[model samples]
Target: MAVSGARPRVSWSCDPFASRGRLVHEDDAPPRSAFRRDCDRVIHSTAFRRLRHKTQVFSFNEGDHYRTRLTHTLEVAQVARSIARALGLDEDLAEALALSHDLGHPPFAHSGERALNECMKEQGGFDHNAQSLRVLTRIERRYARFDGLNLSWETLEGIAKHNGPLTDRDGNGVGRYAAGLPHAIQAYNEQQDLELWSHASAEAQVAAIADDIAYDVHDLDDGMRARMFTVDDLADLPLVGNALLEVRTLYPGLDVPRTVGEVLRRVITRFIEDVVTETSRRVAEADVASAQDVRGLGHPLVGFSPEVQKAERAMKDFLFPQMYRHARVERIMEDAQQVVRDLFGHFIAQPGDLPPSWQEGRDALNEERLARRVADYIAGMTDRYALDQHARFFDTTPDLR
Candidate 1:
């Protein structure tokens, strides 16, 4: 049964009943809490369904077992919830952030995003994080009262700032990517401030770190499954190496598959435990008593220890060349990028070619607005859909096989 009334006091945790409320006001549902409803809404969104066909590390056609965006989101959600539960944070909020985090991702993984970014470079830019905000606040049109999901303010805050503040207090860009805030996010923030200068809730912090953990572990699993690298190859890669050594010490005669599974299990446990321990230590040291305190702390209250962070970086360093930049993956992504570029070009040149809904206000839109609409249309497409559309427009589309 769902808990009713005020959320029980938990140190550095968000209280559902005391939430910042939604952008478009509405009466509350009786049984489910606000955060729980936010989670359910995201699960039912068209964007969520589309993730099943979107790429993670490999294209969908590559194999049946490779991770899709949907699978990755689920893994992130699971990790977020586990961390939330351990830290007495709001699990629903964490899960919602995790599930919704990738909604903005274009097809073909990072390559598609890169292509889209290049296509939109003149019209601001394309960013998955900003795109996610657009997906939640504008693109999703399920609700009659509002175009977007109209999620609670806390959820929106997490969605916008989960990766950390985009700008400083003066509204200037902060990080490497933040120098130019995407138009979508900037427009929304004008109407409703997402506190772009501050950290998100502790739950959001948990979800963000959980995303890092999920990708680190699952990408390794997928890379091995794809034969990009082997277990012995990862035997010297920091945390993974340590996990492999421990697994071998305990289970000397285990088969490769079982050994892989065991190593992953250990890796997950190690990271989760480290996060919980380190976060608890930080909370105590910083005297963080509430979710707001967590957000205002400037630094993340939930993350791996410095030692673990170093090890994780080492793992990523190894994977960058062996898995991400492997010749086969590179070739496939090149084809995928071309498909994105081709679709964007075709649609921009001939706005009439877009679907009736997409071209609804095409008559009055300026060049930049039209380009954004085309970007939106292209961004929403699945990998197979992109290929099919390319086949429709161009004589030869890359096989992407």
Candidate 2:
């Protein structure tokens, strides 16, 4: 568990033994801490398996080298674990948070999410963060004792509020959800309070930042794989530009792929090091002594230095136009969105199209209930499965190529 430059466990690190326990109490399964158990549950879940075929930025039908959601999650977990270890936080908690972070993302990346959100606009606008909680607390029905995986309270808290507080001090929705809380989160909060107004544990914050690192690095890799841009294209970029120069200078005349890999490796190192240093400085200066103190700090402790923060933003800016919004990607995503919308419309109109298991119960369910159900089913589909379903229901489905 020891990482280079990492310290022994710190006082503010989340203690797996001191976890708040699961929502539905069960006897301790010996030889594993609660957070470790939560991590295992996520790995064993059907949703986790589905991630292999789900889109990250590229659809499953895209070239094999492109990142899939499962690959992305693995990279995030690796980053989170390293950061957590370096910061003397709970690596298990961090890994659990990272592994479970994207379970709620629909197929076709954000395209499917947008389609589902638009379809569920009246019921409860789909927020993947909230949907993550729903997936953990309700969707995965593996255990007879519980409908969901019944993760530990700490894991649940991180997944619910990992990005930051969902609400302000007054408890109104804040951050990305300023308009109103997602219905899934709101309903779950009534049953088990996630302390929506406070920052999550330092471990949780590590996982969130790890997600950013993964996206910034892997998206660049995928973008290059797709010929959306090249490593040379990042020469003017801030943090990455320096990395590219250093790599080229050190390994003169390296091939494009090796140069890309080396530059990305340096970027990840610089980002992780900056976060560890900045967060350590904050932890000491702020006199944070416990995980509870971390939650109440009102801001994240795990983040890059201001300079690196700007660099991260600059990296995002570069990708937004050069990769994400490339006409090729946009055209594909637009068609992917159509597939999702078509599926939603069909399921809502012909409830019989839903699988027997999905339609087995709830004859008394209302419009909102049925709509949400249809969304859940659609949201769970892999990109290939969705296209398949569309082909099954409609005469002509999007090629999504």
Candidate 3:
């Protein structure tokens, strides 16, 4: 796959991009289109594979049907691909962006991410998006140029921007070295973009929404299976309850299981449709110069329409209050956070425990890189690996390395 810069003249399949003629230039050798290259790099990255073992709220082994981070990513890819295809966007680029969107998420879900962020607070804070960009451009090793994945700027930007606030712009989320680092000021200035730093691609936004859709409904499904909530209990949820009543009234013969499935499916379908329609309409209206140029374009529809948005807001409010905030989930989050914090502390205080690659000098440049190394080690952990590390640190695991 072609690595850096634009390649000219290649035939693009999608509308805006195809209008641009080609994103790759003729001078580029070892030829591949930029978007295809981005897709390949993500597929080959170690971080992408490790996602299989990472938790997506529920543990990987909790049930045969629970979604791991890997499955969640694939679903996002599927959803984004469909939207991209419908909207005349570059499917390869969109799918690549979606598949690698969560590459930097640490073990045990957002709780672990929060803990890692706190641990790195004085070290510039550990945002999974920034870390994912770092992984692609500076960490993941394979085909060699700096021991990193050497991904295209487009893919890296998409990953960093997947959950970025609407105000962010191109290259905005790339990390800047904090004070005391040798080139801190330079890094910050160089990284700053025309807008907010967390900007994601329109395709990335599709993936982000897909992630929300999967987790929101799936978590409720899991809650039911775990007996955390009964059908009656779910029917008691304010928004879901209201929807349930409507569903039952419309289809008197539908059983609770079928009704539950239909409700979630309907919500997801409705939201997805709203997003796709809005995105396509906005894209066509924008008069974009090309598909490559659309990478930094904001989603014309950030979320659902008024009615659906209200229901979605209500659903989120209900989920937070009823499911995520429940004692069982809270306890799991707390445990995961503590485990992450302890592991980070252990690695920092005794750097020798890390692999030899991380044992470099404490010079300013090296210090920044070392801190990143710590983040990488922590970021790469699986839920089980994190638990074992915690156990070893606390003397609960006798045979730990």
Best by TM-score: 2
Candidate 3 residue runs with Cα over 4 Å from true position: 1-33, 164-200, 231-259, 281-302, 360-369, 396-401
Q: How many clashes (backbone N, Cα, C below 3 Å) per candidate?
A: 0, 0, 9
lDDT of 3 at 76: 75
- Using Cα atoms with residue i matched to residue i, what is each candidate's TM-score against the true structure? 0.97, 0.98, 0.77
Ranking 2 against 3 by lDDT, winner: 2
What lDDT does the true structure give each of the candidates?
0.90, 0.90, 0.63
Deviation from native of the Cα of residue 84 in model 2, angstroms = 0.5
Ranking under TM-score, best-scoring first? 2, 1, 3
Clashing pairs in 3: 7-23, 7-24, 7-25, 8-24, 8-25, 16-291, 17-291, 161-200, 168-196
Candidate 3 weakest ten by summed lDDT: 1-10
Where is the poorest 10-residue window by lDDT in model 1? 1-10
- Native-referenced Cα lDDT, model 2: 0.90
lDDT of 2 by residue, 31-74 (tens): 99888899999999999999999999887777888899999999
